[model samples]
Target: MNEKIPQQSLKGCKPEIHYPCVWQYKVIGMERQAIQAALSKKLGDAPYSLSESRTSKQGKYISLNLELTVHNEEQRLHLYSALTADPSIKLVL
Candidate 1:
């Protein structure tokens, strides 16, 4: 006869986690390098990556794609707060 396993036998299973949340930023009156530096400082030693591009309509603005490899939702919130606090950063998306 076949027998079924008891409940709680699969307690070792772990849920999956997503990494490197993608974020975009709209920054005005700031150079690419300056934004990068500011982000680097805010992230501390965690080592995040960024991509930047420029767009013009009525004036010049720089768009940045930020990647955080080891940050959670709360951490992401903090990062956004920090970036927005900077005078050079016009917007965070």
Candidate 2:
């Protein structure tokens, strides 16, 4: 199911970003395998790095830091939206 999240309004001017830059995203989920699977499905054979960030106090949830190069704003936002919408992903930052 696709869930709609309330979009946050920008209060100030957006920051300038150079194109074809490396971007990092912190993804939280219940299982690492599911998260990896989701990422693999969406990102194909793209060169990226994934590292363990942290785990919940009870060790129930896991957060992974994902770093990848994005060619443009559209690619970055599209990946963010896709990851956030995935059931395996609890949150993305």
Candidate 3:
């Protein structure tokens, strides 16, 4: 279970994030379609928004902004792990 720490104590340790809140991930990869498929496969029925971000001048790489609701730190971290594990995904922020 996740315990909430008072705002005043946030400076002493980990930053406090309310659960079931929207989270964002910046996904960088070579192809937009591959990233989209990976997101769809991993998220399943979860609702999310995916948009184009920066792209290399030579068109070798691109970044996509991903926004979705994450219930807790575990789920958030799990998503990051799964995304980074994909071969089509180069980086996740």
Candidate 4:
């Protein structure tokens, strides 16, 4: 005898797919580790990765690239706002 699965079993079982959002910051007046620490404190436990590089031909400032898993526009905007509000952050993209 063959068994049939109930349709209700699949209800509310839709898969969730997350897309990584990237933010590039031309950060100044602070070290990369400090920025990363600040971000971690602001964004909480959300999964993220950071990469930083000093600009070519200039040792005055550095750029930080942040990769995070975001669910909606609000989250992205919030992150941008928080980063921009910091005095050490020069630019955000």
- What's the lDDT for candidate 4? 0.68
- Give the top-scoring candidate (lDDT): 2
CA lDDT of each prediction against the hidden true structure:
0.68, 0.96, 0.96, 0.68
Model 1: lDDT of residue 23: 47
Against the true structure, whose TM-score is highest? Answer: 2
Give a tens-digit lDDT track for model 2, residues 59-87.
99999999999999999999999999999
lDDT value, residue 62 of candidate 2: 100
**Model 3 C-alpha lDDT versus the unseen true structure:** 0.96
**Which of the two candidates, 3 or 4, achieves a greater TM-score against the reference?**
3
TM-score of each: 0.61, 0.87, 0.84, 0.63
Give the residue spans of candidate 3 off by over 4 A.
1-13
lDDT score for residue 49 of model 1: 62
> Could you tell me the TM-score of candidate 2?
0.87
List the RMSD of every prediction in angstroms.
10.8, 8.8, 6.8, 12.1
What lDDT tens digits, residue by residue, belong to model 1 across residues 6-93?
8698588754556555544554445676777777778778755676655657546777777655456676667778889977677787
Cα RMSD, model 4: 12.1
lDDT of 3 by residue, 1-93 (tens): 999868787666866899999999999999999999999999999999998989989999999999999999999999999999999999999
Q: After superposition, how far is residue 46 of candidate 3 from its true place, in Å?
A: 0.4
